[model samples]
Target: MEEKQIIIRGRSYPLFRCHTLIVGSGAAALNCAYHLVSFGVRDILVVTERLGGGVSNNSGSDKQTYYKLSLFGEGQDSVYDMARTLFNGGAMHGDIALIEATLSAQEFYHLAQIGVPFPHNAFGGYVGYKTDHDPKQRATSAGPWTSNQMYQKLLIQVRQQGTEILDGFEVISLLTVGEGEQKRAVGAIAIDKNKASSGLDSLVVFQAENVVLGTGGPGGLYQTSVYPKDHLGSTGVALEAGAAALNLTEWQYGLASIKFRWNVSGTYQQVIPRYISTAADGSDEREFLNESFPSFGKMGTAIFLKGYQWPFDPRKIENYGSSYIDLLVYQETVVKGRRVFLDFRRNPAWKGGAELRFEELESEAYDYLHKSAVLFGTPYERLQKMNPMAIQLYAQHGIDLAQEPLEIAVCAQHCNGGLLGNIWWESNVKHLFPIGEVNGTHGVYRPGGTALNSGQVGGYRAAQYIAECYRESTVTAESFLELAGPALERSVGLAEGALGRVASPNGRIWLEFREELQARMSRMAAHIRDAAQIERALAEAQAQWEAIHRFEFRLEDPARLIEYFRDRQLCLTQLAVLHSIHAYLQRQGGSRGSYLVVDPQGSASLEQLGPEWRFRPENAELRQWVLQYQFDSRTHHTAWEAVRPVPEDHFWFENVWRSYVNKEVFRDSADSR
Candidate 1:
């Protein structure tokens, strides 16, 4: 590594040079750095706000799963079969799906070897189970902390590899060179939070051959989110730098506890807690589920099914599945302006003031409770009987589930779409790669834990590609300086302008803008969307963005400055999401996957009425299309791209033959044959 000094506005900053610069500190970024070292690539630098700050380390539910092909099942399962399942999951591209599936088993085993304690049987086979949208039993876990375990081990591996990490440095801009097809990532501009906090300006530049983005998802963009509060992803920065984003309209939303910010699926739902809604003063309590479902059995069955069907899906509404519960909760909270809670102390009251009993549940629900030996107790006791850790986990977080009702709501869980990339995880901008939640790998609906697998696979692929193509020697001082010049100037100007802005009495604070953005996005874009609502959201988001420039901030407080930058990024992401949704609605694309476009007129129940109903089957298409968005200098553009099907050569036989010929039978076969 080499360091050069540059003068910016009478202040000198250090320009560090590296082979690769990764902008995140989660599982994906650590995995990419580890693989880069394993492939003999040195001089890698990882810049992040904090180590172990992303969702991978901080968020999980009871039994968080890692989805992959079944290694030990009753019948034979191939990678092709897994690929087919992934391809048909939602509106995903077949090539990316196949790539993820093919590498899944290898990545799973690699994690196991490197110390992920995936549960095993007495005969030494990995135990598996079913997940949402998964046809086979391919999901496995090491309790609720599966992703955290992966992150810890990979963090150790990354440290052992001697990768340089600059913590508390926020990357604000990506520096690119050339025009159109010739454009390539040269480096990035980052601000040191520690220095800024001490009243010393420290703007550092990293001159690198490659930049990998694994900054997780835009968790800060939503008011109601399961993502960590500080995980402000770099998707907006990439988009502003002319990187294309795919399927921004598609996202996953589910019920989660607001106080602890944890998912309330799996064991939380399986143990049939009472769904209660109350007014502002905590009076006029109502057993909402009893009113929504036809009978106590139906409500109980839906609660049990919610363990598997965690995310909200429109199709599930018609099938009497659990997603309808999400709709009912949403209508209660958002539509009727009330608060919803999950009480586990007792059974819910029926319509006629009759107490709901365990005997009233359907066979599927009752049998599971009987099998688990939890049939004769309250929901809290049943949860203890089934998974004692579920109760204890929340207790550690200061929420005693047994003693109190957990405050919960339908919140944004994951982004199915992000920075658009191919099988290699490289963005359209050369030398810039996005992995983990920052990369839009999943389409509309993804099987649970697919995000974890996608991050691993993406990291492996990106590292391999970078090792083979970009090297430290390829990045010259002149080239980096040339590319970074304009970006540096632009960033400095923005900072100076922020410092010079006059405080206005009417100007909105970052928190105010953030709350407004979250409220609008949650109402319009989360589970239900329509053209008119989306159009209004776009206009509102744009107006907010414009208004943000007029706001003032204290130049001495670095945290406030970072929040200002984050506000811009969040607003950009919101606008992109709105644009993508507007385009999809314009094409008359009906509700598919997590994105539900409501049909106003054709529903029977309260859950199916209003803006939450689905379009008729006769008017919808079987095949799905992905929406792409790009921001240029003057305008933002969006278009729809039809998903590509799996190629004929992707068959099992062809893959097996290619592997055998390439590695075993014929060495250097491309020349020999």
Candidate 2:
């Protein structure tokens, strides 16, 4: 392992070359190079350090897409009943697919005839509204930063469609070709983060035949989230250069609420996607019958397509309705514990507006309206008359999202499986291609605004399937440098010195094993999880991935060798979210997404506890009857629920189509000073 003959501008290269590059600049790599320069392919290239930081980069990138209604073979109402009532309010995924939840309004009127603006009124038309994963009313946004105002307007139509952005460039490996059935994928070996001479060369290694990752997700391993900071993890550097990443076991988590003197980049991402609350003793309207309502799984997959069933329990809403009971019922009036006001004094959405119960709209900008009328006690002459972006983000960074009930928690967004493919996104290697949030085409549990409608229909279907694999590849570039020139000379001879320094104890045992895997995923799969905290977070994620294979950054310092490729991608994406929260914590009979659930006569032993369960029955019921027929039909949930797919005795797949169903897109990240 020692091949480093570098050289760039003066020629002498060949560390890796496959071609079609594209790491990410968000909106699934600028709508996969504006659908590979509108299907003509004017030289496609897109590196990244910036550009909508993944998972609908907060939602802009030319007003993303997601409107429902397809009917896939007249299944009538079912991406599992719009994921159990408008997006997994009760953990959805029962092999979700009724033809990708009925082709989301033909991919939202084809991304509003491609340019995306979206916001229209005063007779301009098209505002349909109604979100929670559609039944009709549809979805569209441009204001409140619809994914950063449709990615600045698609990075100015991707630098006026010439395509070649670059930004910071990091990528490091993947350059394979030929060995096992003539392996494929040609170029990639980059680094340049501003390299010396600045002609971009901190170790220039360029070679390409085909590669596209749209690197996003893995949410900075986690500590807290709302994203928008710097979001690194380059899809764990393209699954440590081998690819394969399917639903690295569903890592999504949400708690994004914050108020106690507002901090997380001041007032949550741009007001929790667009606000609401009615509390004051109504406990934000009895937290939909006292807590247990957390389900943004694809705009709430139409509350299970409107039938709604949910009854399980994870301590019935953090034990009786919480965010502290929507801050003591709606907008204030606690008394000794402090939330005060007895009158919303003519409620502008709990008196501030984020559309109180979805649109009635009024309070246009009262920046925490005098600390939410001084924490609901009101009267300081209505807090110097109406507060404005909470008195200018509290006077810039002083934070006060309405008086003070904001300290939300939930973390780890994104990484809903990665690599692996079929429905045209490609990946078992070969010409490669991973479209948006490192493509796993939303496997485990993403259902809200479907990662800006699967990076606008998987970057316009990986730009018409890498332009029909480059008009049917006859293959060249010296047969992709004699097929990825010996896997880029054995990944630059496993990088010479083989890099060193493992113990940071494997990055402090992956940050105390991601804080005990976010307290065993807020307790075996939050929102409510069971089967003994999903067999004790899958036996503490197999002892936190055997201490992340005793980490040792294979030596090198591109910022601690990309945290040694994010400590083996947060231990293989936390062993794919502890084996998909031990298959929804051994579901006895119910649950498929929001935070694991399943128990009803399925003893799920490890201590057993089913009466209806408030929590405690162990080993998540025989690992949900051994992954419902062990990945029944070879998984991607029976190929995104088009069911009946996995039938070729054991591996090497054949027919798996599944596109974006009741889309639960959380693929997010962010950073700041």
TM-score leader: 1
Residue-level lDDT of model 2, residues 1-673, one tens digit each, is 1124444334454243323667777766776777677778766677775555544545221122344443223225434454333223222222223224444555555555565666556765555544433454445555334565456567777788877776766666666655433555666765555652322225446555567777766554444444443464555445544555443444444334323221122122212222233443424321221123333321222121211111112222332222222222221222222222211122222222232232221232222332344323322223334323233433344544345333333434455556555555666566667776666555433444566666566666566667754544355544545555566565444433223342222344333444655445544454445565567666766676555554422332433443333445555554554555454433433433333354555433212122453333333222122221111111213111221221223322232112122121111100000
Per-model TM against the reference: 0.93, 0.31
Highest lDDT model number? 1
Q: After superposition, how far is residue 490 of candidate 2 from its true place, in Å?
A: 32
Candidate 2 whole-model C-alpha lDDT, 0 to 1? 0.44
Error of 2 at 568 (Å): 31
Error of 2 at 8 (Å): 38
Candidate 2 residues lying further than 4 Å off, grouped into runs, are 1-18, 21-28, 31-42, 45-146, 164-182, 186-208, 215-243, 246-248, 251-373, 376-416, 420-436, 439-474, 477-611, 616-673
> lDDT per residue, candidate 1, 1-673, as tens digits?
6788876667777888888999999998899999999999988999998888889999889899999999996867887888888888757888788889899999999999999999989998997898988888999998888999999999988988888888989988888877786777888888788876532265778888999999998887778888877776778888878888988877889899988888999988888888899996788888888766777778888988887788888778865678889888888888888999999898666785766577888887788777888876778888888888888889998988778899888989999889988767888788899999999988766889999999999999889878765654666787665556787787777766654442434455667777888889888888777777888888999888777665533333444666666777788888888888788777767777765666565333334354446453212453467778998864789977788776556348777798665653222221110
lDDT of 1 at 166: 89
